[model samples]
Target: MPAFVINNHGGDTPDFDGEITFYVIVCVFLTAFGGLMFGYDLGISGGVTAMDDFLKEFFKEVYEKKQHVHENNYCKYDNHVLQLFTSSLYIAALLASFVASKVCTQMGRKPTMQIASLFFIIGVGLQAGSVSIEMIVCGRITLGIGVGFANQAVPLFLSELAPAKMRGALNICFQLFITIGIFVAGIINYFTSDIHPHGWRISLSLAMVPAVILLCGSLTICETPTSLIERRNFIKGKATLKKIRGTDNVTAEFESIVNASETARQIKNPFSTLLKPSSRPPLIIAILLQVFQQFTGINAIMFYAPVFFQTVGFGNNASLLSTVITGLVNVFSTLVSIYMVDRVGRRILLLEACVQMFLTQTVIGLILLTDLKPTGSWNHAEALIVVILVCVFVMGFAWSWGPLGWLIPSEIFPLEIRTTGFAFAVSSNMLFTFIIAQAFLSMLCHMRAGIFFFFAVWILVMGLLTHFFLPETKGVPIDAMVEKVWKQHWFWKRYMVDVDDEVIKEQVHPHVKYVKYGF
Candidate 1:
């Protein structure tokens, strides 16, 4: 164990270190299946919507428009009901997140994840057997609720279980699984697209595979020590910590977690506490990261990649193949993030990705604006160029914003409001995702090729804001974040008011001297 040292804030901060054990690895792998469910849904919806069979069954108008030889390419799939199939999930997720927060806090992370799996399985069943549009929409709403719970718990579970030094890499497993899910879903869609009248049903039914994995896996994994401790299962918490860390030498870390939990116990209403000036920095940062993440337009593209490719003049087979290629890029790029995030830090990846994504989006927009007309499709070479550019853009997003968006929010908040704060972050992400998924087809119709430019502008804004405002959280201990991160940051420091070292130390842990910020 590393020696405890006095931080510049005049608090004794223990260096809580733990070995990477096999048990921990297994737990993370199982918990991260939650991301697979989310990713499958994201990848499946667009491909299913683009399927001739699916559109003919539920969206007859879209089927007719698609068949029209002279139909405006941008407007053919801009039906509100079609958009609802994709967007309703996110809107339901947004509302369900608040409820998920309470369940995560009260029932613990493992139970919440199990609940997510159950809901997801039911949703999948509904979608697979649906005869009416209403049944499918209801299924989407139910699946959204599952997504809400999984999103709420998985990142937090990963963050809390991981060693501080390994937190970034492990938490990214959630995103890695998400990417893999998308890749798998794309492949499944490609194979199933030719299955006659029931192809879409086969695609929808397969989503239950991941949900079942999550459900069975949740039963096998141990509850996070932080959750156990917060719920006052101290003996079990310490024992579980020792087992996961693969060592019994966890006194310093255990005490730190207990101290943090004690502080959390004082605050009866974490939501109201979030309204305090001290809490505003993390709340603002968490919410803005989610909003900016969506405004980057990644989900819009993921949800409509096949449609977008077809709009650019690819045949059905070609469009599905193109989406698969991009999905491959997305999965591989996220592996790069998992490797580099802890080594190079979050801000560097994010800023670099912004530049890459902006350039690609801009070039793609210029190509479409100049060449592809409302009535004419791009020739083979120009269409290929657009596909390559989109893959480039997806690569940038997968490596940076995709994983870090979930990672940072899950790790930033103090234990007192961790779930509450993350709930807000999840809710914000879902809300913006709902907006984009619902409106992207319409926006594409109106803005034409300019829609890519719209996302490009948002990318530029995200770059500036990240450079100026986002703090580097690399190597900072989760329990000591207020003292080491926020207080050290230039702009966010203003929101953290100074309290007497002794008083703060006493409130957190009397035996170990550590200052806790008012925030």
Candidate 2:
């Protein structure tokens, strides 16, 4: 066992050998489904938006044939209604995340998630059956509720259950699936474009499938060990720990979790602790990481890549096809992230990805600003270059900000504050989602492609901030991480000395190491 893992809380080592349990994987997979749904909803909407002209024509024909309708000219103009349609989810998510902050902490993680799934079913049904834009907007708000739930719930769940060695990697998988979901949705929309001039009701409606799966899967999975222990469900908590770890390792792991939770409960109220100076640094990191994640305008890319491609003069089929390429890049680069995260660490990936995003976005914006029209029809080679650059941006995000954004919040906070802390962090993220997405269409009309210049500046600033402020947290045990963060902050440094001394002793003294704090 690593020295740091043996001495900190109370001296004890968990059993090292045991069969791997599927319980944790099951939870991860189910929760990942929520991200997948979020992605699918995101990707499909973009392609649907790009098809606005075609849908208008199709709807026009239907209306004209029905009653020679003249008063309700639904197809006379392309209103880009799809843009608002795409953004509704973010608005709903912002609202849901705020509400979920209280709910997750009060009702517990599992039940809150169940409630989210209910919203998913309702939203998906409304969207599928919508006869007007108002109905679709209503569904989006409901769907947003589900997105808000997972945004807060999955990271908290994964961070609590994963062993120290694998926690960062596992937690990042939540982000990975989000990228995958975006990719899958893009691919499906492109392949279905011919049949989808009817407005992609099926593609949009399919989001309900994963929600149902998650609802069913949640039933089989145990509550988070942290939550189980908090409610004083020791036996079930032990059983839950065993299921996540293994029978042989359960005793030590459970004790560690119980100890961490108790230590946190002893200190202060979890929600109020977020206000304390001691908690401020990580909370800042958590909040800003999420803010940067959104401001990088990655969602703008995912939700509007198809429209951007079309605006540049690509054929309709070709524009949708380019979205599939973006998805491919997102998926493969995320796989690269999965490989390097544990080895290369979070800070490096984030820094490099941020720089790459800034450069690519700047170049893309410059290209859009050019007046060089295709000599004949739109130049395929020039368009393809832009398409490739856009894919490069997707790759940059998949490897860094996308996954690490979610990873930081999940593992950074103390146990007592984790659920509530994540709630705040996620709410911050969703709020940005609302701001960027809701205003994106209007901004594009006013600024044209130059709007990306704004995003370029946003990505550059975030990269620099991350370089200075983000802490290195790759393999640190969760319990000790809070104290370490306080030790490094200027205002908290003097007070953290004794705590720092204890940490050093644990590090330097081979006789003592961080013992697992059994839950």
Candidate 3:
């Protein structure tokens, strides 16, 4: 068990305060459907793009290029218009995240989620029924807006609803569901790929399944206690807290939430307040984590796994099968993360995965550089070795950056800036995702085997940053993080000193004081 260094606060750590209840479980499971929608889109696009029918119907030029027996393997799929079909959603999502922040803060997390589902449903319809390229791109843009809203709200909702001890595991349900969505989409694409003339349409239309589930689920889950209290519905907030905890003895926890909400109410402009020196740590950390997460090149792998396999040496059927194999590896690896996050702590998982990922990336790059050439294909045994190496790399990422990227950013902010801060993280993620998705095919053509080395270097930089700057937040309560985490860190502590002094002047309670942790 992790030890707590409690300062003047008379009670034990808030980590021990609440019991998990069935109601909370149902709520978490439902909210996690939002990730399903996002993930399906990620997995489906590449598979659909690889389908002969899809390319023939929408991208005839690329399809004709594929017919040339001597075409450069790396350059066969490099078309700007084709790339736009996969990348348009992320650009739309980047712009929509700001609007989501306002809706999430003003109306609440539930309504924002509901809106996300509705938009996704509309997008699925447009894409499934599309006859023209213009219609399909328009559908992708609509889906991006829904993805932006869901990404902004779901992580914050899970963090606020879970008990401190279970927060990491529960919040990871979002990532877990994302992996499941990818796996399910892979299965759908594998079976549907055999259906002539309309397999891609079937794959695109199936996205509505998760959106419909989210739409119905959002109506049943209660509003988060923190969100309720922040909106001044104190009576409902306390009642809701009691219901989720499965006990009426919620005075201490409820009081802490109320106090945090009161402090939040005093700040009128959360976005500007985020620019203050004291607020810099979480904000900067949140942004960097999102940026680094994308730089890992995980999205590039997930978005274009089918196309990538085809580029190496695999036939159309074999490439989709390899993608399915990688998808399974991703899902199971995320389950490992859910079990281990709170027990072993975030930093250890991150650091260890960095070592694992760097080695795998280096090996893959060397193999491709030495053996595989731009114009020829590798033998079956060599191709299998590359696939095995890719699975190992995917395993390393699935358990670390993939989930924690969203988890840490959601947990670190104070209530006043919570939604706004998360919006920045979401926007940063979407922007980088757009850049990578848009550029990966071209990069593959130009860089060839060297692309893996580029990502390996980024993995090294992220590991160094994690070691020097990131703090462990495993068991810290959401409301008490500023006192326990920021004020106690070696480098971040200097930034918090002035904020501590101001808190001391404004503090009304005798028991509350700055917490100092030895470990």
Candidate 4:
């Protein structure tokens, strides 16, 4: 390992040393504790929802009222208040994303993250100590706000700070931590489900561990050099860049970043600037990418894994164990994506994942409908098959959409409007995520295995979108990407051909035709 990993100092020149220094690793990964908190909160909810005592304590009134008589409805809750309780956090996150964007742009990355940690601490406190259902809802909304802020800031923090070579993998670390959080929560849920009412509280409160880590860690790290420079503290920016980069040769690079900031500041309207022809391509791509990510229904699994397992014939303990296995596979698959993202490029991984997901989802749906008829069919062998298929479905998603979904939006936007643009994109994520998370259980209950068919169709659609619009951005310098692709026509024949970065820098302007191959 080298002494430090370069964070957030991208410019015209990129260092390809592939050095993994301890300082750089700690700074980036620990700061990613914010992501860990994101994951833990997501993971905790499923387990808590799965807890029998939790339902008996908090959901007793509704349960007794709707036990025998129920109406089949799309999202009328079907009297399952758990769906509303779970999706409420995402609803709060949707609103909070816009606010987090402003804080990210105005207060700087580290400071914005610090505020997020504060929210997490308070939210976790409320949730852990809650005596009533209303209090738990309040805690979830508060935690959602914290997560929304972290989701907005963390990916940008990684992209802006790490060396160009490390940018993709480092950004992926955030998504990776999300899986780790889910995995940890799965284990906690598994053990606590049998512990009675207090065990549910313990599971929910465990998120505090990562929340505290994020809070204390954010205090130790310096602000991103670019954020500092944008704030007109070029002196401190330069110093911080050197400390993380472990080099004194950041002067030219510093000047380049300063120049970009100055150019963006001269723009009178950040919002309208994205409407210009030069900015349309990246902005549209980023927006649609978020749509595709959520529509894939990964969160439906993450949030409702235990519920799905139980529906397919697994007992409570078995269901939680299967959830834990899913979390483990989710984390490991992300590591695979991080390893190959730069080497293999973004487009192929997305395409392959889409294909695999499409296949797995279709098959999983078919098996559930045919073999396990859900009424009289009781076969452990078929249940095990369903579980295995779900694992394969998760493996398909873990590497592709899960990581790149966050990365592409973070990197594609120009420095001037990156924060604003990305926050808007993330807000879209929360928006669709809320829709999916809220309606997922209803879909499963009403549609049965057809829910898998629903997600499979979406996976196929996302693949087409990727084929037509997504660009091959691996190993391209941030400056080069902004210059070469940002100004191109949105519908141009830029079907993500593998262009040499060196050649890209050599050609200042494009010809009328970008590439011969058109999707």
Candidate 5:
């Protein structure tokens, strides 16, 4: 068991009386391991694609017969085959995520995570031992199911555990772990890239280490205080809350949670309630934000970064090295986001990132459109410029869409339907992710530089949508956000609304806190 130490890292004080405790941080850190595994699965393919030995073994005819094909960059598989390899996992993930929504509610968060971990380990074993393409696809699909559960559960668990003031930062830590996973995968792939006969298998199998760790970590942590209270086990909830908050005086905190739970309990049917007009605003934002997140072209680049580098004139070694560097930049930039999310707010950073990304993608597209020599033969300056643009693009994504996309939807819904709503949003994310990741190579093979232009256009569309719909959620109580932010019909309303503590008292449902608090 990890030591439960109370390390006080100073920051904007949380909504509670005391500092955020070390237990809260440890629970969140361990839960965020799911993201690391998710990123590892997304990234390991890029390295495997670069391995001729793996490709030659898996896609025999394509590798042997295609004399003029770009052997080193692409895996030499036909477009249909590549599409199947990537999209199959996403298809399974979509289904599993819906199931996880119910599983988390029934079995609770920790058990749900262990379920995901088990699936991940099983899939990894199959992938490493695979002797056929069919077997690899099967493994990927199983892994996707695990990813679906992990992705849906981890952020929700973090949000429920976090104090309102620190929620955004802790939630952003989930994205940071994702980049770390990608970085680790890239580094592993780099060192093993030359290990010809079975290096790719070794790379695919290394993810098991983290999956096991996450399962063990989940065992040691407490269930979310929110879930505990909602279950009407007030005595246990109070105890858990004290452990997490590290103080005995939880009167205000307990009342707040009771109020939130009572409010969520208002619905007769979660689905019917979501269909109501009052709920439309937040629900729409959740779905569209997820859609926009995937369409940002982040995964198209991440899942194939090495191949992209090779496409732009990098040699095999240089391409993998460049991918590792991109992963590092992604991690560092997300740390910037985790630190700044509460201070700067979500919309501003998202807007700034969208502008930079729009410009970078447009420029990269235009450059690629120009007649350029193949991988090893392009101008050194031109190749360097392309690399620089990709780096900037990744940095922009890491700070904005990468973390905020996962963070916002988790907090946007009321607790009554939060699991169902978040599950749908996550499914949307993977659905669009499937479309983008599956079509990327096909688009690159046929449309070539046009692929970048296609992505840049989507970025513009998303930027417009964000400006109109996204709100500043930093330090806002989840229920308060529902009444004041999402329920407000107009975009400018969030900035215009004003409220003091008396007004807040009026806004909170009187019957909720009083009855649930037994006073």
Candidate 6:
């Protein structure tokens, strides 16, 4: 067991609290490994996409022979095959998020993560040794399931365990690792763009090594103390909480958790809570956030950054290097977001990002409308300008929607409905992500201008929706926020006037009985 040192990292605080205790950081850091896995899975596909020729050759006998058999296959089996291999994981993730609560509740968070790792192992092995494209697609689908659980569980795990003050930063740290993984994948793909004979396979297979190590390491750590307490393992729960949360005045904290648990347990199967009338508003917000995050065009840029560069007239090699730059911008900007989220606030950042994103998408669309193609081989200067605009777009997203989009759903819902709410939210994210990611290259392939206009419209609609429906969540405490934020219905009244929080509170808390209300 590691030494239990109180590092005051998360939750709201003055500077004097210093960082969270070393042990808490260590425990939290272990959970962040799940983010690393998420990031790696996200980036690996881009690298694999760049290795098209190598991948085609490796499965040559299968793809070439199959191409001849399927009469007039206009879909280009090679591209569809690649798209399916990449997106199958996300498709599975949509399914997995729905069931993640069962894994977390029955097996606990640590064991569920171990189970995810097992899927990673099997998925990677299938990809590395597959004789047919179908095999690779299946592997990706399994990987998707693992991703689904990790994506939902990791943030919920970290947020519940972290101090309220530090939670935003640490939670944002999860996105930081995601950007890091994307950066690393971009760099590896750039350097290996020319390497023949199974380069993409090698790139894709690196995920299994870390997954194995994390899986093994997970077994030794304590479960989420809060989860244990919820399960009525009070003795072990208190000890585990004290160890991870440090020897500070944990009495109030303990009581708060127990109270929350008791309140939550009244619902029994809380996973179905999202569909009930009381839970609909937050569910709408969660699903919209997920949809907006995808529709913001980040993944479109990420999965096809190289292709975008090439369309603007950069060479294949230069396009890959430009993608690396995009990844770097993502990583560094995400770090800035981690620092700023707790300081400046989530709402301010989100609004600013949404507007900025709208402008950038508009500009990119206009640039594409110019129909500017390189006269010669490649115009490095013009390409660089487009690359910079793409980075600016990325910067806007990293600060606001990218991490906060995921962050809000986890924090905004009542504990009673959080699991189901997140499942619906994240699954929506993946479902739209799957559609956009799969159809992205094909969309651009058919009509580049039309697709850019498609995203341009999405950005405008997202800006309107956020302004009308979403609440400001920065600095608010998590456990009671669902009640606190609901008293004011002006935030969401435009969307569902009939289901206003003020109207509901009159019924749920007659005379404002259970929770205190503020103007």
Give the clash count for model 5: 0
What's every prediction's RMSD, in angstroms?
Answer: 3.0, 6.0, 4.4, 7.4, 5.9, 6.9
Q: Tell me each candidate's TM-score.
A: 0.96, 0.85, 0.95, 0.88, 0.90, 0.86
* Reference-based lDDT, each prediction: 0.92, 0.72, 0.89, 0.77, 0.80, 0.71
Model 4 over residues 256-366: C-alpha lDDT tens digits?
Answer: 566556555656677887776666677888888888888788888888788667667677799899999999999999999989998888899999999999998899889
lDDT: which candidate is best?
A: 1
Candidate 3 vs candidate 4, TM-score winner:
3
In model 1, how large is the Cα lDDT of residue 399?
96
| After superposition, candidate 3 runs with Cα above 4 Å error | 1-13, 500-519
Please write out the lDDT profile of model 5 over residues 1-519, one tens digit for every residue: 121111111112225654589999899889999999888888787778766777788866654733444453233333667567777888889889989988876678888899999999999998999999999999999999999999888998988888788889999888999999999999999988889799999999998988998899999999987788766667788788888878887656676666566555655577786776656666788888888888778898898787777677777778899899999999999999999998989998899999989999889889878745333346667888988899999999999999999999998787778888888888988898888878888777777777788888988998888887777788876545655455354753443333344543444455554565665
| Cα lDDT of model 1 by residue, 80-143, tens digit | 9999999999999999999999999999999999999999999999999999999999999999
- Pairs that collide in candidate 5 are none
Please report the candidate that would top TM-score against the real structure: 1
Candidate 4 has an lDDT of: 0.77
Model 1: lDDT equals 0.92
Off by over 4 Å in 1: 2-12, 499-519
Task: Give the per-residue lDDT of model 2 (tens digit) for 1-519.
Answer: 421243233443443333436767777888777677777787877776666433554344422332332322112122345456767787778778867866766677787777778888899999878777788888888888888987777778777777766777778777777777777888777766677445477677777887887788777677887888776677787777777777645554555566565554554566677787666777888899989998888887787777667656577688888888888888889878878887888999999998888898899878766743322234678788888888888889999988888887888787767777787888888788777776675676567667789999989898888777787777666655655555655554543324344544443343231232222
